[model samples]
Target: MKTPKFLLPVGLACATVLSLLSAFNMPSWANFKDAPKEIIDEVWQVVNREYVDPTFNNQNWQETRRKYLAKDYKSREDAYKSTREMLKGLGDPYTRFMDPKQYESMKVETSGDYQGVGIQLGLDEKTHELTVVSPIEDTPAFTAGVKPKDVLLSIDGRSTKGMDIDQAVNFIRGQAGTSVALKFRREGKPLTLSLVRTRIELKPVKYSLRTEGDRRVGYIRLSQFNAYAAKDMGNAVAKLTREQADGFILDLRSNPGGLLYASADIARLWLSEGTIVSTVDRDGQRESITVSRPAMTSKPLVVLVDGASASASEILGGALQDHHRAVLVGTRTYGKGLVQSVHSLSDGSGVAVTIAHYQTPSGRDINKKGIDPDIKVELTKEMAKNLKADQVATLADPQYARAVDVLGQQIAGMPVEQVVAAAGKPFPAERQPVAAENQTPVATP
Candidate 1:
């Protein structure tokens, strides 16, 4: 049967709309052909009908597809770069294209093993200058004389002023043989330092035994839940136990986070074999991360935390607290419950997206609401002075004293009040804040 002329034109138009809608549903222009025909058609139809952008056209899309499949783009490298540009047009940094080489590098970095100076660096909130938070002891950065409070100006002549902390780390990290020059300002003097990049396998957990007053307490600081953190923690605990540590102080003050698996493993040290943390995706799909019943010791514990404690820190703290395995001291923690999964891009750069938000074993949502300490204490001037003198900025920080005090009380079989009375009040009338006259802000002329 012969089709009507007007109906044929209308039918062709309808078909075009359907095809365009399908593309919208799948947005990956390069991969559209690989998708099911029905899905592709749906994407095209949706885009044609609902997309507010007036530039939508079948010809433009066809040309984009042709360029991707062209034979002249002989190398896989060329094809990937072209595809990357196409994805970048979307302007979402979270969804960029990365080649395999760059993607693999990211995977290595995320695994918490890389070649570089060992330091956690960040921008100064007040100065907006790059600052070294802490240099892991015994690493290239630590041995090469990188210090906290040192403001980085440049790395290899590249300005670090406007770069993010992660970017600075990337700049400093290189193959084991290469040397990176770092320029920094310390105490009004500009200093230049050069060091070779070496393999850095960070051990996140560190511990020591200290006799505070009459009781010997174990002090363990966990920097991040990296690949070896759980094992490191176990060894630290074992070492502390051999030292006859009467009580435990688990310090998780400035830790950011690393592997989720490591976090669960660390938590399992003091927790029963059960849900350490639960995750909820954007779609409301829920899953839980649990651990096996395996650990070195189950001693009376006190975990110290502050505003900088985040992610896996919260997970470990929440688990111990819920299980009555430890008492939390110091200040509120940093709440970062989102779990990121790295996806390799064709351009070598990896994209990490927040696939889920994790919850504590007790069903507490640790995303925005951080863990509150059982005992709140401020850092003492004396402790700060000690830290400054020892070149140990974080350890002698006030949070350390709080942890020791809490654990000391537990050892003596008395409340913190009894220990406070014996040691005398740390803060007296002289330590109280002095009040000044309330003044209004002066306007600049």
Candidate 2:
């Protein structure tokens, strides 16, 4: 919900867990000997006290802890396995354990820089296989021809059949100049690609000006909502406005959302007042409310989103859509409305526990149920292939083209509400009921 202001500095993925750890004067684990129980107790205590669902999803958390606590851990790995098993019972994917290495990697990524082959991975629930969510544009993976929905068969020749998402990522990531061989199945055909890992410095926001039917549209692509997201977007919008751009298209196509405050700050650029998003804690009480400030640039806006758009991305998009500030184009969002607060452990390891569930301005719970686009446009197989091959200009992207078209017809100085009304969509006037206490926040990534 309302993380300490300090936690809001970086991307949600890179929130400062160490700060929280330091405040409690947590003891350090010098070694693994006799550390299993302490680590387990720390996790259990945090979840017991702060988990968003106070009922522990209707299960007896005390008993659950007893079940794990009764086990005799022979080593650190055994303790990790037991802790993971215990968390699995909660059925929340976003809330999980991260070892020291994984936590460090997360910190690097959220800092908007990392040394790795850039690609986002997820677990396929039904098949229990690793899948490629998307490749960071222009990264080693994207340049090597990775695509969304590609089934990862192996990493560096090791079979990935049973590997978790974190394991797969670790295996694929390496120092700059080193190569990681990725074996994947695409279109039912097994294929292998050798990608040389490198330093990935993410310029989260990229912009361009496109002319459609004599109208200049500012096209801003937000790859991730990291620390620089708001400032970068503000600069892009300001420059575009100076260039006399009549409309704006905020592209969040493959964006896996980042920091909470980053999203709120970006929303403030458009919305002058009213709630942007709200977080409800485990006790069904409001934890924090992010409201809009003065408008930045009120140019007619369209937000482009796809299934890969999630978390903070959903927050920004949902807020604009609810306030009639932007017409959402493309498919539904990835829907990750749950909030995770990372906490460091004494062993340099960490846990990102779900502390609250976020609601859009209209009070809609978009956890598993994502926000639908006002106009739907699917990226066809042919279009995707052509676009990937650099055969089509980004202006030819079906979704971008549609957004430009919609914005072209909008009156340049019309109010956002009037623009939505002209498109035959009714702007929501009231917030919906808060989510019920028993509602589970579990979902596959």
* Candidate achieving the largest TM-score: 2
Evaluated against the true structure, the overall lDDT of model 2 is: 0.75
Global Cα lDDT for candidate 1: 0.59
Residue-level lDDT tens digits of model 2 in 35-129: 67667767776777677887887899978866776677877778887777777778766667777798777777778888888888766656878
What is candidate 2's CA lDDT for residue 420?
55
TM-score of candidate 2 to 2 decimals? 0.86
Clashes of 2: 2
* Cα lDDT computed for each candidate against the true fold: 0.59, 0.75
Off-target runs (Cα >4 Å) in candidate 2 are 1-34, 125-128, 388-393, 412-445
lDDT of 2 at 169: 69
Could you tally the backbone clashes for each prediction?
25, 2
Off by over 4 Å in 1: 1-101, 110-113, 121-133, 143-153, 160-167, 176-178, 183-196, 242-244, 291-296, 345-349, 362-370, 379-386, 389-397, 414-445
Residue pairs with backbone atoms closer than 3 Å in model 2 (clashes): 12-258, 12-259
Q: Each prediction's TM-score against the native?
A: 0.64, 0.86
